[model samples]
Target: MLYLSQFIKMLLIVVIMLQWINPAQAADLTVSLSDNQGNPLPNIVVTLTSPATIIEEAEFSPQHPAIMDQIDRQFVPHILVVPKGSYVAFPNSDSIQHHVYSFSKAKPFELKLYSGRPPQPLEFGQAGEVAMGCNIHDWMLGYVYVVDTPYYGKTNARGQLTLTVPPDDYQLILWSPLLDSKDSAVQYSVDVAADSKIDLSLKHALLPAFEGFEQSDEFDDY
Candidate 1:
């Protein structure tokens, strides 16, 4: 009879320990950014940085699971953020030939014009907003916003973004190609809880927009 009682007590302790080691939930956030006029800004980048502690069950991997493509003489998702040391594939998905090139702070590589996947995809081995353009199609311009964090997302036409992030302390950053002036970007600290709702709104950058054909004009001016 004593053995049976001891067994029951041990089982209860094991069950309680299991519950304490449970994983944290992913946080929920609703982010938005715009100009003083409240106009919706496209290509807005939102970043949620976790605290130094392990809020996320998984650490950020060096291998980024993301890709950007060139189609219809345009780069899909004009802006993207990938973890550092990530391999971003730039596959050509259009009928016309494309000559991909980038001159950003991150990786600076180029691909000659080719058709049908061009053997392999261009690997972006660094982190930065590398500006991409096509020599053949001057009007073909795109921007890849390379980021090191894992929890990030871009806003849609509604100027809002929802990204699944591990619960932790984060340095929230708001980025956009457009903003009225010095107020183009802003970063703040936030404590993200699992499934918690967060929101933000900021002005767009007032800088000149990317014009694929602008390169041609620059040469002519010189």
Candidate 2:
């Protein structure tokens, strides 16, 4: 009887340990955004922030530095997303010199005119949108979306984004530079469980486009 009691206690401890070690189930989230006319809206940044309890318990680390290349006097990736505290590399691929600067309160820094990669990537320690522009090119614009949570995705040409994340309640944010600069992003509360899909329709039309850029009707974040 004494040996049986000890064995049961050991089994109970192992069960408790297993429960503590296991993580919650995960799910996939797909988001689609479009204009009132049903036209796809690309370059939109979407972020999902889980509850504080889930954030503290979530096991995730920022990946390698992201790259924002300067090509043809424009930012290659007009919209860039990175986790908080992640580094971003600005490589000037064009022959002409390019000076990158941002006035954003989240991270404000300037890379003096250069033709190649900088010594080190710039670190984004805060979670907010950073609007950067080239001093030489008035039309050159880009956006850096720094998010604290790991669950985020940028919309593709089809205005669709898909990402996998642990099932939980989250705060969802959608940002687009084309939206009136005054109100560039929208936020909502969502509960994600099994594979889910969300369609977002903008309440206001996007701002006017820059005529001199590649597409006369196209606009990028400033």
Candidate 3:
């Protein structure tokens, strides 16, 4: 009788874990990216990748948005963050029509020059940064951060990001377009508590980013 009771109790515990517990917790995480010499990096993209063990779900995803403009022959915000597989709409808020395209490795698509809003948002279903350009202007440039993990953020001018996450040991990653190292990814181990701060400094710029080309060859694939 005792053995049977213990077995029943164990089964109940397993059932509760499968049905009641959630695998992922929603935590707020902040991140900062800088050069090898510790200068704040703007327009650098960050992403939280999954460890090899996780097979079912992604680490994170971005919300939906479709905002683009051609004011003064420039792309507003310069850089954007989006979830993999989400859609982004292009609205020509300028008097003249604009042509937009990305030759980045993740996914490349083009919107032929036309005024007003485009019919659909370009859907990117990968976790990487997609460089955007106004094919007409050699000076116009922008970036899209396609993130798969939820714990990510952009740094301010001071290179600061505060992340809220469940208190646990995690692998923290940082990336920038001009990271002194190869891919600009500086990895660290973090134990994030409530409002805990992780301050980091990086080296100097490694490569001279060409103004005209938005190619993935900019970095060595870090």
RMSD (Cα, Å) of model 2: 5.3
Q: lDDT of all predictions, in order shown?
A: 0.64, 0.77, 0.63
Q: Pick the candidate with the highest TM-score.
A: 2
In lDDT terms, how accurate is model 2?
Answer: 0.77
lDDT: worst 10-residue window of model 2: 53-62
Q: 1-222 in candidate 1: lDDT tens per residue?
A: 999999999999887777677656566766665555677666667777654532232123324345677766677756756655555666677666777787776867787756675445445556567888777776767777766677777778877788776677788876655544455346677777756555555543357776644444323322
Candidate 2 clashing pairs, residues 3+ apart or interchain: none
Model 2 clash number: 0
lDDT rank order: 2, 1, 3
lDDT of 2 at 5: 100
lDDT of 3 by residue, 1-222 (tens): 999999999999998897668654545556655555667665555544445212244322234455666566677667767666666767666666667888998878777657654556667778787887876665667777777665566777766676555555677766655555644555677655444565566655557867444332312222
Q: Write the per-residue lDDT of candidate 2 for residues 87-205, one digit (tens) a residue.
A: 88887887667788999999999886576545477788887889998786777888888878878788889999998987888888877667765345556777888889988877777
lDDT of 1 at 150: 70
Q: Which stretches in model 3 have alpha-carbon errors above 4 Å?
A: 1-44, 49-64, 181-183, 206-222
Query: Model 2 segments beyond 4 Å from truth?
Result: 1-19, 53-63, 181-185, 215-222
Model 2 scores a TM of 0.79
